[model samples]
Target chain A: MTADHLESRRREIVLAALRCFAREGFHATSVRDVVRESGLSAGAVYSYFPSKAELVAGAVAPILEALTGVLDAVVLDGVRSVGEDRTPTEAVAEVLRRIYPIAVGGEVDYTRVAVTAWAEGLRDPAVRAIAERTYGTVRGRLTDRVTRWRDAGHLPADVDAGALGQVLLSTLLGFVLQHALLGDVDLDRYATAVALLLPRG
Target chain B: MTADHLESRRREIVLAALRCFAREGFHATSVRDVVRESGLSAGAVYSYFPSKAELVAGAVAPILEALTGVLDAVVLDGVRSVGEDRTPTEAVAEVLRRIYPIAVGGEVDYTRVAVTAWAEGLRDPAVRAIAERTYGTVRGRLTDRVTRWRDAGHLPADVDAGALGQVLLSTLLGFVLQHALLGDVDLDRYATAVALLLPRG
Candidate 1:
C-alpha cells in the first residue's frame, strides 16, 4: 500500500476502535473486537495497532483535537474579540452557551469516549499518559487566556491563572459528565453560575 | 448463618467487588474476580450477589450512603444554620473544603469507582438505573436546599431551584472527576468561583 493508503487504513481502524470503546468500553474490548468492528482482518488491525492501549491512544487523538478546536473557537476567539467592547464575562458566557448544546446533543460520543478513557487510565499507564497530556493541553490553553484577561484588566491581579484555568477546565469536564449521565440538562442556570465567576467591569 | 453473620458476609463481598471495580474497570471484572478478591468460595459469593449486576448495585450502596452523609453534613447543615450569620456561600465553601481533602487523598476509592460506574452505565440498564437514581437523589436534595435558600432570601426569588441544583451537583461531580484524574488540584479557585455564584448580602 502507498503511504496515503496506509494512513487511511490506520484511521479506519482507530475510528472502529473508538466506536467499540464507546459502545462496549475499553476494558471489555479486545483487539479482535476492533478487527471485527472495522471489518478488517486481524493482521491488518494488528499492523496498525500493536495492542489495545495503542488503539486507545490513537482513538483519543481526534478527541483532543476536537477539544482544542472548541477552546480556540469558543474561548480564544472570545478573548480576541474582547477589544470590541465585549466584557470578558460576556465572552465566557458565550462560550458556555455554545458548549451546552454540543455536550447534551447527539454529538456527545466524544464525551462518552472520554468517560471510558478515565476508567481505562486507572489500569493502563499509556492511557493515563494520554489523559494527562490532554488535560495538560487544555489547562495550558485556559491558563493563557486567563493571563491575557488579567493583563487586560478583566481579571483580578491577585488571581492565579493556572489555578483558575484548572477550575474552568474542570467545570467544562463536569458539564460533559453530567450530560452523558443525565442527558439534556438545561444549561441556563449553569451559564448564569459561570457568568458570576467572570470579572465584571 | 445468623442474620447478622449473613449481613457481614454480604458487606465483605460488596467491599471486595468495589475494590475490583476500582482496580480493574467494571466491564472487565467478573463475579469470579470478586470471589478471588474476597477470598470466598464461588458458592458463597453467589449466595450473596446473584449476578455481577447485583454485586455492582450492592457495591454502590456505601457510596450512596457516603454521598448522602456529605449532603446532610455539609449542605443541609448549611441551610439549617443560615441564621447563625453564615452566608449560603460560606456554607458551600466549607463543604468544598471538606470534600477537597477526601477527593484528593488516599480515601478516593469512591471517586475511582464512580468513574467505572459511568462507563458501565452505558451498556448496562441496571447500572444506568442506579446511576440515574443516585443523581436524582442528589438533585432532589440540592433542589430542596436551593429552595430553602431562595425562600429565606439568600437566593434571588427568580432563581429556579431545580436548575441551580443541577448546576451545583454538576460542579461537585466535576471536582470529583478532576481530583481523581489529576491528584491534589488546588481547590481555592474553584471555591472562589462557587462563592461568586452565591447571592451577596
Candidate 2:
C-alpha cells in the first residue's frame, strides 16, 4: 500500500477498534471483534494491530490527543477558544463546548470511552501511560489558569492556585464522568451551573 | 442457618465479591471466583447470591448505602459532622473527610470499585439503577445545601442555587474520579482548594 493508503487504513482500523472498545469494553473486546467491526480480514487488522493491547493504544491515544487538541485551543492558545479577559468560568465552559464532541457527541462518545480507558488503565500499563499524560497536562493547565485568574484579580488574593486548579480539574473531571454516564445536562446548563463556583471579575 | 448467621454469612460473601470485583472487574469475575474468595462452597454462594449478577448487587448495594449514610449525617443531620452554621465549603470538606475511606483509603478503595461499577453500569442495568439512585440523592442534597447557602446569605443574592449545586456535585464527583484513578491530592489540600471558590463567610 502507498503511504497515504497505509495511514488511512491504520486510521480505519483504529476507529473500528475504538467503536468496539467504547460500545463494549477493553476486557470484553478482542482483536477478532475489531476485525469483524472493521469489515477487514483478520490478516489486515493483524498487520496493523498485532494484539488487542495495540488496538487499545490505537483507540485511546487519539482520544487523549483530541483532548490535548482542545487544551491546545483552550489552555495553550486561549486566543482560539476565548479571550484572556474572559472569566475563568467562561473559559472553562468554552473548553467544555469545544470538547462537547469528544465528551458526548457523535456515535462514539469518547468521554464514555475515556471512562472505559480509566478502567482499562487500572490493569494495562500502556493505557495507564496515555491516560496519565493527559491528566498531568490537564492538572498543569488548570493550575496555570488558576494562577492567571488570581494574577488577573478574578480570584481572591489568597487563593491557593495549585489546589484551586486541582479542584477545577476535579470539576471538569467530574463533569466528564457525569456526562459519560447520564449525559443529561447540556452544555449551556452546565456552563450556568459551573459559573456559580468560579471567578467572575 | 439462623437469621443472624445467614446475615453475617451474606455479609462475608458480599465483602469477598467486592474484593474480587474491585481487583479485577465485573466481567472478569465469576460466581466461582467469588466463591473461592469467600472460601465458601458454591452452594452457599449460590444460596445467597444465586449468580454473578446477584453477587454484583450483593457487592454494590453496601457501597451505595455507605455513601447514603455519610450524606445522611452530613446533609440531613448536619449537626453530626459539622454545624449547620459552617460554610458550605467547610461542609463539603467535611463530607470528603467522612467519605475518605470509601474514596481512596480502604484496601478495596470503593472509589476504584465504584469506577468499575461505572464501567459495569454502562452495560448492566442493575448496577445502573443502584448507581443512579445514589447520584439522584447526591444531587438533591447538594442542591438543597446550595439553596440554604443562598438563603443564609453565604452566596450572592442572584446566584442560581440549583445550578450551583450541580457544579458542587460535579466537583465532588470529579474528586472521586481523580482519587479513584490517581489516588493523589489529600482531602485537606482538596478542602483548601475548593474553599477558595465557595462562600467562606
Candidate 3:
C-alpha cells in the first residue's frame, strides 16, 4: 500500500480497535477480533500495532489528544478574551459553555474507555505510567492556567488554582459519565450552575 | 454450608470478582479467575452466583448503596438541621461535606466500575436496567430535594432542580475520580475551594 493509504488504514484500525475496546474490554479483544472488526487482514493489523496494548493506546491516543486540544483552546481562548476585566464566574462560565458540547457528546465513549484504563492501570505499573502521563499532562496545563487567572486577580485570592482545576476537570468528566450512562439528558443547565458556583473577581 | 455460611462465601466470591474485574475487564475475568482470587472452589463460586453478570452487580451494589445513602442523609439532615434559619448554601454545604469522604475513598473502586458499567449499559439493556435503577433512585431523590430547596427560596429562584441534581451528582463522581487518580495529592484544599464557591447567606 502507498504511504498515504497505509496511514489511512492505520487510522481505520485504530478506530475499529476503539470500538472493540469500548464494546468488549481491551484484554478480551484480540488482534483477530480487530481484524474482523476493521475488515483488515491479521498481517495488516500486525503491521500497524504489533500488540494489543499498543493498539489500545493507539486507538485512544487521538481521542485523548482531541480532548486535550479542546480543553486548552477553550480555557486559553476564554482567558484571553476575558483579559483583566472579566469576573471569574463569567470566565468560568464561558469556558464551560465552549467545552460543554464536547463534554456531552464528542468523546464520551473515549473518555469512558480512558476512565476504565486508568482504573485498571492502578494495579499494573506499565499501564499506570501511561494513564498517569495522559491525565497529568491535561491536568498540569489546566493548573497553570488557573495559576495565571489567580495572578491576574480574576479569581479570588484564596482560590487554589490547582484544586479548582481539579474540580473543573472533574465536573466535566462526571457529567460525561452521567450522560454516557443516561443516553439523552440536557447538561447545559447543569454546566451553568457549576459556572455560577466558581469564585468571581 | 449453612445458609449464613453460604451467604458469607457468596459475599467473598463477589468481592473477589470485583478485584478480578478491576484487574481484568468484565469479559476477560472468568469465574475461574474469581474462584482463584477468593480461594474458593469453582463450585462454591458458581453456587453463589450462577452467572458472572450477577457477580459483577453484587460486587458493586454495596458501593452504590453507600453513595446513595450519603445523598439521602445530606438532604434529610441538612433540611432538618437548617430548620427555619439556615440559608440554602449553608444547608447544602452541610450535606455535601458529610458525603465528601464517601465519594473519595469509600467504595471508590466499585464506584469506578459502576461508572464504567453505567456508560457501557447505555447500549446493553440488562446492564442499563441495573444502572438506571441504581442511578435513577439517586437522581430522583436529589431532584425532589432541589425542587424543595428552590421552592423554599433557599436556592436561586431560577435554578433547574433536575439539572442541578445531575450537576451535583456528577461533581461528586468527578471529584472522586480525580482524587483516586491523583493518589498522594492532598485534596483537602480542593474541598475547601469547593466549599468557598458556595453562595453565602
Model 1 has an lDDT value of 0.73
Q: After aligning candidate 1 to the native by TM-score, how far in Å is the CA of B107 from where it should be?
A: 6.7
Largest lDDT belongs to which candidate? 2
lDDT of 2 at B26: 80
Pairs with steric clashes in candidate 3: none
The C-alpha TM-scores of every prediction are: 0.84, 0.91, 0.81
Compose the digit string of candidate 1's lDDT tens values, residues A1-201.
999999999988987887788788788889999999999999999888898888998888865776677777766775555545344344455666765555435423767777888877877888888988888887787777777777777656876777667666766776677766667565676666555445443
lDDT over C-alpha atoms for residue B98 of model 3: 62
Candidate order (TM-score): 2, 1, 3
- Those runs of model 3 whose alpha carbons end farther than 4 Å from true positions after fitting are A78-127, A199-201, B1-7, B80-124, B184-187
Instruction: Please list the residue runs of candidate 1 whose C-alpha ends up more than 4 Å from where it truly belongs after superposition.
Output: A1-7, A78-108, A148-157, A187-193, A196-201, B1-3, B78-90, B99-108, B148-160, B187-193, B196-201
| Per-candidate local distance difference test | 0.73, 0.75, 0.64
Relative to the true structure, candidate 2 reaches a TM of: 0.91
Q: Considering chain A alone, what is the TM-score of candidate 3? A: 0.80
Better of 2 and 3 by TM-score: 2
User: What would the per-residue lDDT of candidate 3 be over residues B98-147, giving only the tens digit for each residue?
Assistant: 65565445433654455446444644576677877876887777667667
